[model samples]
Target: MKILANDGLDQSGIDALTAQDFEVITQKVDQKDLPEFINTHQIKIILVRSATTVRKELIDVCPSIEIIGRGGVGMDNIDVEYAREKGIHVINTPSASSESVAELVFAHLFSGARFLQDSNRKMPLKGNTEFASLKKAYTAGIELRGKTIGIVGMGRIGQEVARIALGLGMRVVAADNNVGKASIKVKFYNNQYINVDIETEPLAEVLQESDFITLHVPAQKNGFMIGEDEFALMKTGVAIVNCSRGGVIDEKALLQALDSGKVRFAGLDVFINEPTPDNQILNHPKISLTPHTGAATLEAQDRIGLSLAEQIMNLLKNK
Candidate 1:
């Protein structure tokens, strides 16, 4: 079987495929040339990340493709339902990168609370002259120990975040349409773990009660999930973090909230339009931003590759 890792696959995945005597192509293919390349190579499986788009048009043109694999959680880049309707298996390693994404959520949450992003950017330029002033400016940081962190979606990633929050001595409340409750296993540095049961609350209740809100929901089909009304329900000066899908939170509403002091700080790893996020939020003083790299850790990539390889082997091998 032939597989094209168009957006680039990790070495672990490539080795796994090679061990099974499968041909794995890691060449970069332009969107325009994808159909021709797939047809020419007789590729049966196509793997992608966020950079590549696997829409219905491409899937229709490439008749040989039997499976579509995504390296991360979101399948926004791929037309999953359309592909599945045509008998193509669409697979993603949702659990593989949970820890990595959870860590990034804290990275932003901790840094934003302490004003690290601003300090890092300004320190180099003004540290020599304004060191004492900068120190005093950031001293009003919030401590996460006793704060409440509301998770919007309590899936694998959300549960992982909850684990970290619990370990930090923070209160965790989550809201999910599908999940009523979840048992999170919090692990400590001493190699000990404890399971805690948490019951999910209503969206409005979570919003009104939490000191910090983190989003882990899927991309909304119609419009923004958290906009003016949702923002209004939230606690004043609440810090928000979104490392999930773009278009889940309205960027314009977020900016306005920031301006009005309704939202104290925002940590965003995903944006409405990736690669080119809104300039206003990018330049905002109260926002901490990262290029959608929640699942970019080395360990996450390796796990993603291994998981994809195993799934591919199960489906395509011995066929």
Candidate 2:
């Protein structure tokens, strides 16, 4: 069988697939030419990350494709239901990158709490000239311990974030309309563990009470999840982190909140317009930014690759 990892799969996954006699191709294929390329190459499986889109039109034209695998979570980039309805196997590794993304949430959270993002930008320019003034400005950082962190989703990633929060001794309040209750098992370096049970509450309660809020849910279908009204409900100086999806929170509302002191800081990995995100948001002094890289860690990519290889072999090796 032949596979085209349009967005590139980890070498570990590529090796695994090749060991099973599957030919794996890792190269950039233009979106406009994907259908022709698949047909000409007779590729049996197509693997994508966030960049490529395997929509109905591509699926309709590429009959040789037997399976569509996403290396990371979220099938929003691909037309999942439409492909599956046409008898094409659609698969993703939703749990593989959960820890990596959760860790990234904390990365942003930490940056925001300590004003590290702003500090880094200023230290290089004003460290010698305004040492005392800079020191005074960044002296009022908040500690993570004993603070409340509200998780907006209770899925795998959300649960991982909760585990980290519990391990750090922070209070966790989660809201997931779908999940009523979940358990987080925190393991220490010495192998001891603590099991914490999490009972979800309503979104409003979480918004009103949490000292820091992190969003881990899928993108809202109609509009942004956190908008003007939602921002108004949040505690003053509440920090927000969004690693789940772009446009999950309203950018305009967020900017207003930051300016009005309703929101203190924001840690953002994803944005409303990706690749070419808004210059204003990029230049915002209060926002800690990272290009959509929640699952870009080495461990996560390897896990995603190995898992993808296994699934691809099971589904298409014989076909």
Candidate 3:
């Protein structure tokens, strides 16, 4: 079987598939020509990250495709329901990138709390000229220990963040529609580990109680998960982080909260628009921003690729 990895697949995944006698093509095909290319190559499976869009039009034209594999979580780029309706298997490595994303959430949280984002920017520009002045500017910073972090989604990624927070001595509370409770185990450098049970609470309670809030929910079909009213429920000066899907948080509301001092700081890895995010959020001094790189780490890419390759092989090898 032939597979087309349009948005590029990791070399590990390609090697794995090739080892099993599956022809894996890692080429950039123009979106307009994808249908023809798939038809010409008779590709049975297609793998994508976030760049490519597999919609009903593409699926309708490429009838030979048996599977659509997303290297990471979030199938918003793919027409998952339509693909399934056409008898194509849709798969994603939801668990593989959880640790990477969870780590990024902290990367933002830590940097934001200590004012690293601002200092890193200003220090380079005027470090020698205004060393002590910059220090005074960043002296008032928050510490993570003993602070409460509210996780909006208690899925794999959210749970991993909770474990990390607990290890750092931060109190963790989570709210999830599906998950009622989770057991998190934190391991120390000395090989000692502690297991803690946490129950999901009401969104309002978590919002009102947390010192910092991080979002890890899936995309909403109707609208944003958190908007003006939700922000109003949060404690004043609460820091916010989002590594989940874009559009989950209302950017407008976030900006307003930041301006009104309802939100002290924010770390955003995902945006409503990719490659061309809103300039308001990008230019905000109080927001520590990354370009949707939650799953860009090398380790996560390898795991995602290997997992995707294995799943694809298992499903297609039988046919």
Candidate 4:
């Protein structure tokens, strides 16, 4: 059997599949040429990350494909139901990258809280010349120790964030469409751990009370989850981070909020128009940007690859 990892797979994953006599191909096949390549190679399985799209059109042409796998959590890029309806197996690695993504969330949160994002940029340009003036400008940094962190989605990633927040002595409040409450297990380096019960609150309530907000929701198929009205519900001078899907928070509304001083700062890992994000958001001084690297860690990539390999092997064995 042959698997086309269109967006590339980790070596561990490739090795695992190859050990089972499966040929794993990591060539960068253009979207327009995928059908031809799959047909030519007779690919039995297809694996993809965010860079590739597995819509109904491609699915219709790739009749030899037995399984369509997403390397990360969300299946928004794939036509999941349509593929399953065609008697094809659709799988995703939901738990694999949770810890890695959760850590990046804090990377943004900490940078925002301590003025590290702004200072890093400014200090290199004016550190020696305007040392005293630079120090005066960044003195209003906030602390995350006692601040409240609102998690917009209480899935695996959200729970990880909650665990980290609790460990840092910060209050964790979360809101999810499905989950009412969750038990977050905080692990210490000394092998001590504690279970903290967190009840999911209403979105408005979470928005109103939280000092910092981080999103972990699935892609919104219909429209923006956090729009103007949602922004209105948040506290004044709130710090927001979106490592989830792009357009989850209205970009226009976010800019307005940032300009008006309603939102103190924003950390954005995803964007509405990826690869070519809006210049207004990118150029904004108050926003910290990363090009959708939430699950780009080495550990996460390895975990995703191994998880996909395991699931594929198990499913193929059953077949």
Model 1: how far residue 3 lies from native, Å: 1.1
Off by over 4 Å in 1: 189-191
Per-residue lDDT over 1-319 for candidate 3, one digit per residue giving the tens place of the 0 to 100 score: 8999988888898899899998988889989999999999999999999989999999999999999999998898899999999999999999999999999999999999999888888999999999999999999899999999999999899999999999899999999989999999898888999999999999999999999999998888999889999999988899999999889999999999999999999999989987799999998888999998999999999999899989987886686
> What digit string (tens of lDDT, one per residue) describes model 1 on residues 44-101?
9999999999999999999999999999998988999999999999999999999999
lDDT of 4 by residue, 142-246 (tens): 889999999999999999999999999999999987999899888887899999999999999999999999999988879999989988988998999999899
lDDT of each: 0.94, 0.93, 0.93, 0.93
Tens digits of lDDT, candidate 2, 199-245:
99999999999999999988779998999999999999899999999
Q: Is candidate 2 or candidate 3 better by lDDT?
A: 2
Give one clash count per candidate, in the order shown.
0, 0, 0, 0
Q: List the residue pairs that clash in candidate 3.
A: none
* Regions of candidate 3 where Cα sits further than 4 Å from its true position: 189-191
Q: Estimate the TM-score of every prediction.
A: 0.97, 0.98, 0.97, 0.98
lDDT comparison, 1 vs 4, better candidate:
1
Clashes of 4: 0
